[model samples]
Target: MAAMYQVITPQKPAAILKGVGPKVAEKLSSIGIETVNDVLFHLPANYENLSVMNLADAENNDKVTVMGTVMTEPAVAYFRGGKNRLTVFMEIDGIYVKVTFFNQPYLKDKLIVGEEARLSGKYLKHKLEINGQRLIYEAGGGFRVTYPMGKVMHSKTFNKIVAEVFGGFSFNYDLPETVKAKYRLLSVREALRLIHFPKSPADIKEGRRTIKFYELFMFQLRLMEKRQKERVRNERYIIDYDIDELKAFIDTLPFGLTGDQKKCTNEICRDLKQNVSMHRLLQGDVGSGKTIVAGIAAYAVKTIGEQTAVMVPTEVLANQHYQSFTDTFEDRLTIAKLTGTTTRKEKMEIVSRLESGEIDLIVGTHALIEDDVLFNRLSLIITDEQHRFGVNQRKRLNDKAHRKNVLYMTATPIPRTLSITTFGDMDVSIIREMPKGRKPVETYWRRYDEVDEVMASIASEVRKGHSAYIVAPLIEESETLDLKNVQEIYHMFLDCFGEEQVELVHGRMKPAEKNEGMGRFERLEKPVLVSTTVIEVGINVPNATYMVIFNAERFGLSTLHQLRGRVGRSDMQSYCALISDPKTENAKQRIDIMTSTTDGFELSEQDLEMRGPGDYFGVRQSGLPEFKVADLAEDYRILEHARLSAIELSGEMREDA
Candidate 1:
């Protein structure tokens, strides 16, 4: 009933194309272009207008393509620094213009006298200079598409290859005809053609719109499919714990839970009560008490004779969580900590206790997912700072138990668009309310020239029996970047304060050394601590009222917020000073946003807009779809439309089936 399949489908190797030798194919493969469809989907980054313009109508600094007759032969003029410039005089629309090409002496023989040529470049009328890069001896002129080819191939050569493939193949459209007609979108073949070789700017715009919609629509469809699969019924642990017991445990805490924390805890408990597996994301701003909420959930799970695994990105955080949980549950639950630095005998004993169900809960780093570390009854898996782990790493941990619940926690408040596109398969719980008696951190932006004033303020705070955290961008000196490093700042602080008063911490240090430095600072024995961004996550010192970040412009707004959250944990009036002399507008804006608002969600939205979704928290590794045409920040409306369309279409297909 079906026709024979063709051998040269879109999935065929791209080396079959003309002018594509083994070397060219290898080069293409380096940039992730390995198939015929890949070559088709490699859209242009921008379009260069090569349409000829009259010299009289062109303005200064305008990128114009002008057709002119060469009045004199091109001559090579030697310049300083062993450089040579090829200058050619041309007559365009009865006006004389000088075209110069620097370090391109070979052009003198190609640009002959009295021959009409087309030159595309910036026109400077004051000096009558046309700094030209493109010189065409041909007749046709239109728009030249520019791609993101980083030394992969020349634009002209790539364009010709794309044209050959375009002319030789046909594409099958993914969208149904009815949907395409309703949306007024071009077919796949036409859209790809126009995107690669457009006649005008409008053609490029139309083609890009169609491609963006297609990319988003397909992505949403895949997400919806995955969601449906995840929703299928599975045998899972039904956690039923005593209400009075959880309440009594909560009562023993030092502080009352906020409304948001209680709400999230209730939501998580409700999910655990069901037999179905739980997959939820717990999003909260820094210092919003996510740890306590997760702790409560884990405590509830443990009541049913089930074990919980709390995994963190760093060993320091693992140790912190282990200590916090042990203190909170004190003799009510048996908790063990495992990390790379754990002694072999200790790890073996912990593993034996875990296998025998003696350990009610275990807090560790990636060591939790080891092969020999088997669990008796693992029900809930909590990953703190979920963005730092890859999808495969999470999956390996999830595979430890059959149909276990996963509660991913992040201190970075993700934007709404990213939350939908990236975590669409999971339900989300947000905790936005801070605990009572917590004061907002007073934020200030200071330039490098104001270092004296900043230091004076920090000194004053330390003199008041409070500690200070000084953060730098780099751990050591970098030849390329001139930003401040931890060692430099450590020495500077040592000069201001004696060696006994200052402690330095960085990632390269051993866990014992880092913990020692942090312990000294936490104990208030060291009034000042100099460190890198490793301190951005854990280590809560309520008495540390001052946070001074050097070269704050090097970090994102969300990072700055997290760093500032290190302080402001207590009722004391805390202050965060951002120190930098930014060289770019974007960097300046990031610093300004940090000083303007303490809301992590608002800063995340601003960050998404400024740095885009891919760079926002490294979403690419966080299970975000790598979109070719659709931008999560700019095309949110289109994303919404595409999502709705996918839902409707899938429902229709289900009914039809």
Candidate 2:
């Protein structure tokens, strides 16, 4: 159950426990700020102490709060492109001043001709204009110190305690002096005061430093605890297989497996052939051929007359794997799917086959974990996009394998340092190569208005017997950013090309419908497919040579790359065009780097630096333990320190025990 939040006065803060929240206290509970500790830890995101500066001295257009009177009334005017702008012509002192408030209807009523108020905001002077216009800038600072009007202006509501504190009141909490001293951090009250109404930039920096450290420390502690729990379990599996058969299977492939793929595959096969059960993780980049390697491992167990269960994060991926395995292994393996969409009769047959030891492999979503799906001699369990499953889900799947080997596959590149700490208990293998003959995709970032020209180019390729994928970020329109929906893009393509030219698939579609839609695209029944990221993984359409992503800026670096990876599979030259809006430097940089390089490892490193570890891990959706404070990719130093500390503490605990 979620914790009940309560606010306690300075005199009785300690008396109020988790369950002691009053009715009103429950109503006023701030999201993210749950308990007394949460309230204390809710340090300001930033601080702003308004420094008064003369209009002339404020170079680089710094925001300034200045006393001014409305010398003229605001006029509502509409421009040529239906733009409604409110011009507030203000005159202050002997020198004339003009302020233009854009698109604010009530601004005309709020500031009268004779009214005097402080106009605070960033302003820039137009050199050629007769009158320099001041544009209002929203004040940014800690919530508590901002004025009531300021809070009301932004429609933000805070606790009464916070409101009072912001209003210049102080509170006394029972924080231990020793803890504070040890951390060399400021007191809660002092930190809050400085954060809310900082007098200087240095004060704001200090306040943030103190709180950021605590947050990082707590995050490290949680990761360590989780790591400790996983280490204590005596889990093992052994694999014994004919090495010659594995080698023969590899040799049979039309294309030779890369050295990296072979190395990673050997790592997995080695683990399974061990005395202890293998808990292994396979990390790779998009199109690095992790799935092909997975097939070899699955077959190893199958050869030993044991059933293997492979779990994928999505139905599409499951189906893709099912097809791929069935195609390669043929009648040699009795493979079945147990997804949510699987019919009762189909599921029953799968269950019976599994119980009877007739099924060689099983692929599905969470449905594979159903109580009735009993397995006979289940020796190998594999999961794709391992991050989507929680630790418990992975454990449950592992439990099904009994003493069988467990292999987890990820498309996201894990930072080296994080890989060490998170997968401490699991043997790790990384497949970092694409199959030979795979061409590097040409990536481009362009504006939405360039859609017609891009479409013309894609259509030309389509006429030449090539295929393309037009991907949108969302299936349907949401209240968020104005992005092209799958439905909208699908129709737009049909209108641009023809109704018979394009097909659409999204998560909202039924399983059969989605499969059919994807099949049409894959088989070239439909030359162009417009869809969402539901096609982000495992739906291979090798003939597709053009990949266009709308609102590409909104997608994580890894996801964008993966979407691009869908193409460039065949011998034909492929192009990945990113349809971005008025591009920011960061967005341009990301798209440009992808365009310039085909190295997944290099791209992963750049992704780590640009998007940070959170974005990388978040997109990879690999179910590895996510660190709160430590970026396994970036914060290697902190992770090392925490690891050493954990080692020392564990030794002490063992000695005491």
Candidate 3:
């Protein structure tokens, strides 16, 4: 039966359908609809309630469908900008009203004088006007589903295509009968049909609920299967490190580890000692000292004579980790750095040493995932800024080892919703406590008119032997946006502070130039560095005491937090000035939140609610599955129910197998 269902499924190209030629198919593809299944799943964005309403009872601007007699001839009148309006007189419930259609001249031929018709649109009671777009010469009406592809294809054409497809065949229900009964879900065919053409509002709601649950349920099932596959046990990968040696190493550190850091490190070490493969996600806020925890885990792997690969997102970050690890391990371990800028000869030498087990830890960017880079005994893989890399890239790096033990670290705290859906397969550990003596960054929101006051505060801080960062959203001035750019800020700062004291860095700059600018800022040679959001992640400067972001409303709350993290790394009192004149309510809320609290997790939750899951991390780069119906933010309750159902059904299927 499953085989038959697979064969009968409508996986054919949309062009195979009648009236869907190459041109129409191309238009469909433009909106991500390519196959018959795609067209069926392209659900309506909204539904137009065309239920008849009495003209006397209807309020102003009320959406209504009225059955009335056309009393006057439809006359086309020319408006400004060469636009035309078709107007006619209609008598509904014995009240005459003017019905207007803008730019729809063809309707004049259909709305005949002294004829009966139904018109659906917004009704203006004071003017006795019914501004309408849908004029049907038919008899009955209910709810009209409005597809998202109004610009791609006409509503009538799309409706015809959908009706033809629905009339063509039936869909196979994949969910077991018992499971369907348990969840009170509609079958696939019934749900799709009702969602496309529902008789009542309840039908639309029920159909959408069923589809959303099924989508989330199937997604959870796939994740469970992957989790099962990754649960492979191999005793050879287990590490037995010397506890005394690790403690001694920790004692040698300049500062004591935070409780959260210690707890996470212990969690990671325990995972390494187990026989089963380890897949854990370490979430921490910016400046929470996650690197040292990861460093401790890597050192544990090294103690047992195994190599660890530390992959970071940027070359600058790779260098930072390489230096930190080299400093920490001093003469005890061999560490190497690999990046795109590494010379071919140096890269080959490093690769040879790594293959020969001469190197204990290798820190790199995407260069570490190249096929030629082989490890002698890769036991633990640590990916920093894990969100910046896609799942396939991480998998490629994990494939280098037989028994996979991956530790993914992200400074950007994952929202609770994403932690359950996107990283559901992995175990999670969070480091919420900052290191001792580190002060929280003082955050403030200032209007663009107060730029001079903000600059004065920064100048005062600079005079105290501290450095500052001026971040802008764009590198150059944009014709459309009236926001400040890095170039303009850099020159302005250069005039205030000497050229040698100001440096400019942006994404468009050459890597070497950017690195040089950042290096000068780190050395405090440049007291002020104007940059774009390129400095958002992995650039740590403890001596920097001030962070000023121009057009702060342009950035997400999570991003604003990350940029603020660049400062307050040291014990010195640090400040972050958010300078922007926010216009919209959302923009104003972002600034208020930025000034209110410094908690990354809280800000991330607000960000998820405001921008939704798609833009939380960019949709394409987020490595999350694209659901046809379920939304991770708005449909969280449905997601939870579906997850539980998937777990129960999966267990039953396993028993039967």
Best candidate per TM-score, number? 3
Candidates 1 and 2, the one with greater lDDT: 1
Query: TM-score of each candidate?
Result: 0.88, 0.67, 0.89
lDDT of 1 by residue, 1-657 (tens): 001111136467889989899999999999977877777777788777777878889888988889898989898989789999888899988889999888889877778788888888889988887998778665676687788888889877888888887778866546667668878988767777888888888888888888788887777777777777776665456677777888888999998899999999999999988877889999999888898899998888777788899999998788778888887888989999999999999999999999999998899999988889899988899999988988888888999974489999999999989998888778899988988988999999888889889889988998899999999999889999999999999998899988989999998998889998888998899989999998998788889999999999888888888899999988899999999998999998998888888899999999999988889886568777777788999998887877778888989978998
Ranking of candidates on TM-score, top first: 3, 1, 2
Cα lDDT for residue 544, candidate 1:
92
Residue 655 miss distance in model 3 (angstroms): 4.8
State the lDDT of candidate 3 residue by residue for 133-190, as single tens digits. Answer: 7885545666777788849897668877878778775675456677689889888777
Q: Which stretches of candidate 3 lie over 4 Å from their true place?
A: 1-40, 79-83, 103-115, 146-184, 251-254, 654-657
TM-score result, candidate 3:
0.89
Which is better, 1 or 3, measured by TM-score?
3
How does candidate 3 score on lDDT? 0.86
Question: How does each model score on lDDT?
Answer: 0.86, 0.69, 0.86
